[model samples]
Target: AKIIHEELATALGPNTPSYQTVARWAKRFREGSEDVNDDFRSGRPVSVLTDENIELVRQVINNDPYSIYDDIIAETSLCRGTIEQIIHNYLKMKKVTSRWIPRQLNDEQKQERVRLCRENLAKFRDGFWRLCNIITDDETWIYHRQIHHKSTNKTWIGEGASPRTIVRRSKFEPKNLFSMFFKSNGPVLIHAVDNNETIDHDYYIENCLKPVVKEIWKQRKSNGTKDIKLLHDNSSPHRHPHVINYLTEEGINIMPHPPYSPDLAPCDYWLNDYIKQNLTDQPDKKSLARAISKLIKNIPEEEFKKTFDKLLERLELCINNHGDYFEHLIK
Candidate 1:
């Protein structure tokens, strides 16, 4: 740009190219073309715009849109610029990063998800408020760490303002495992498992979950409710035959949940995020349990109700998407 301005000033005294003019010339110069004057080639007119080449390039890209420009050039026998133009202007395809799905579902898994969503949707449509009887649980690992403000979370500042440096949060400290159980009203159980213990079938059922289930059942029975629906993910411990027998004996109905579908779960979509956002530093298991219990009790009942409603929306979304991840449609 500076060189173009100098040349313009030298050729025509007191005349300067506008910024846009200089930018245009600079773009052309940067493309490795030094000759400012256009040169006409003597031969058949050079063209890659034939219908055959365009169709051929489109077919090649339709086979695999992730193909690079070089691949398209090899297949269509067209130049890099021509391939790029066809991809961008002709076919109108834009590259996008693949989003994170919990896990890719096979055909059977997808069918099962559709079936479960349909069943839940029917039940929900019959009695919308019946979702209040649902007792859902899930476990998550809480890291003893803090997050710094990232570049994506920054804001524009005025000139001369002090510059702020972003610091990366460390995660070398010990973490704790916690499980939560709740209805659309409040938490029924929030247990932080011992740091020394692994949450296998024996530990989860015998030590943590069964006692809470009995307590919750007693509480509900005293309040004139006999049956309650238990909704948890299809984790190994949760799906064990012994655990299922225990729940059956306790009179808790295990709700039908499709495998590999966390997006449809209230705990995954809302409660977990809520807990993580409100979580503060806690030193040990006792402190973590107390903090998590307090936070769970403090959450507004209306928030949980909204989560139940979101479940309906998500089921409909899943059906619409044919069992695909529906998290992107939350907003």
Candidate 2:
């Protein structure tokens, strides 16, 4: 007390309480005569959050590190203050300090996409519909792993649940499936294997594509359409010299689709999603084969017709929207 009083008096003025007088007053106050000491207080005491709640927070962050505090609170039923305290005291987490990243296509790329869409539209609309028809094709691998519906859960099983025995598969099991889509036809043709080798250009041409093309030509002949066009993306097999030469000699027009333009392909963007939905809950080799067959068989003839009709509709929409759809495509 005396030291404090002396320091204060020296810092302030000589008229302040002297050190001895200040000490006498402090002694008097300490003898239960007065409440002179300032209250020893601070901001609200820190909270103690539960370990379980902290673990829950860690789990949520692990699952999705980009989630905000409010999202964590909503998911875990933890209050905002509790979450903040847990993050600050227990987790010692810090907010990321980084510049904002912008996602925007440059002007030149946008212009090129727009131009390509416009050119394709013009070709289809210029009274050469027979010669300029578009057919987008691409291949996708189908694994033979057991599949289940998104809604399936363990609760769906019986109480005395004995695990079902599954035969172990060999490493080289020929269970992979290769499929291709013809935008004009809803028939998703499944390529068959003659040996253990995966399908390449030769296999595709021999087993799958040749038959489909023949069927298309037969239909065209029946409809009295002499000029036929096929549109395919720039995949290695599709762009093979032999394949191109064969199609050229056969007087079939093959339009080359721009690379990295899957978003613009209706078969890739639309029909694939449709097919995947039907494949849910169909697992194992036998059931998968059945599901594929059922999906293909159930595609109404009118659906194929509608797909072709949508191409024209999309082309018109692209032009009317001033290539807005095309801009979205590349993005």
Candidate 3:
């Protein structure tokens, strides 16, 4: 304490640090700290956070981002605190939950995506009526437990006390498949497929596709419009001979959708995100469907318009990227 105080008095005449601050610095230096210079409580120790050590930590992390602090410490001569400070504060990096992509596309799939986007853009060059007329559908598995991001789970808790525990979800949690159909206006229907139901050609036509088409027809009839453009992935169930015949007979304009292109679908990119955000506490299948339905129905028309507008921007981005994934561009 006296040493730090004397140093402070010599440095700043009559504006020396208080006894408490001096005592703290003295204790820090006594605890094997090499530096006699005092820093803010949260500031790094100059002896450890050197430029060389920082570069070493960066190199080790670049080699393996998932490397733990202890591993990095073993690789370099840095202490755990210094490694963590370099990785988090200096590098501005964080561990985040991995998103689930539908499939890894090859070169051919990429070219197809680009071609489809360009063709669709040329087809609907003038206005958004084609987009508005488009009805998209997709099936997704709805789990009882929603994914909680690690970044979002942080809280202002008392020091030394852990955050409150949430109910641990199982890796093999109970889940059900749901087929959702939607237009530019809003959701048309969200159907929960029955348990033990095989989503094959016959099952899809009878249960999901047929019912969704009827609903769209009824809606268009009420609005004094007849033509409806359908958009769905090229799944086997969707491309079955009977399914094609049914759509053709019904006079629904089938929009071309490339396989493994969920990013182009509003249901996957927009509605699913909405449901995950609004219905974060889903406890059962029925409750989840109900919550999703309510949320979908409650979304404002302006929001739907904005979402549809984004399709154009995404399509243009896809074309510009030559059919590569363009999410990073938006971010």
Please give the RMSD to the true structure for each candidate, in Å: 9.3, 14.9, 9.0
- Candidate 2 lDDT, tens digit per residue, 183-290? 454553555344356666886677766776776666566642246666666777788887877677766677645455554566666666666655644446566667
Per-residue alpha-carbon lDDT of candidate 3 for residues 263-320, written as tens digits (9 for 90 to 100): 8888788877677656666788788888777877899988877887888888899888
TM for candidate 3 is: 0.68
Off by over 4 Å in 1: 1-57, 67-92, 148-172, 214-225, 329-331
Prediction-by-prediction clash tally: 0, 0, 0
Estimate the TM-score of every prediction: 0.70, 0.53, 0.68
Clashing pairs in 2: none
Worst 10 residues of 1 by lDDT: 144-153
lDDT of each: 0.80, 0.63, 0.80
Per-residue lDDT of candidate 1, residues 1-331 (tens digit): 8777777878887667776888777888889879888667688666777788889988987898788888887887788888778778887888787788889788788888999999988987887437877888899987655342253447687898976654565566677888888888888877878767778888878876676777675776675235578889889998888888877877678888899888988889888877777787777778777888898899899988888878889989999888878777667
Q: Which has the better TM-score: candidate 2, or candidate 3?
A: 3
Model 2 regions more than 4 Å off: 1-109, 130-134, 145-175, 183-185, 193-195, 223-225, 280-287, 313-331
TM-score of model 1 vs. true structure: 0.70
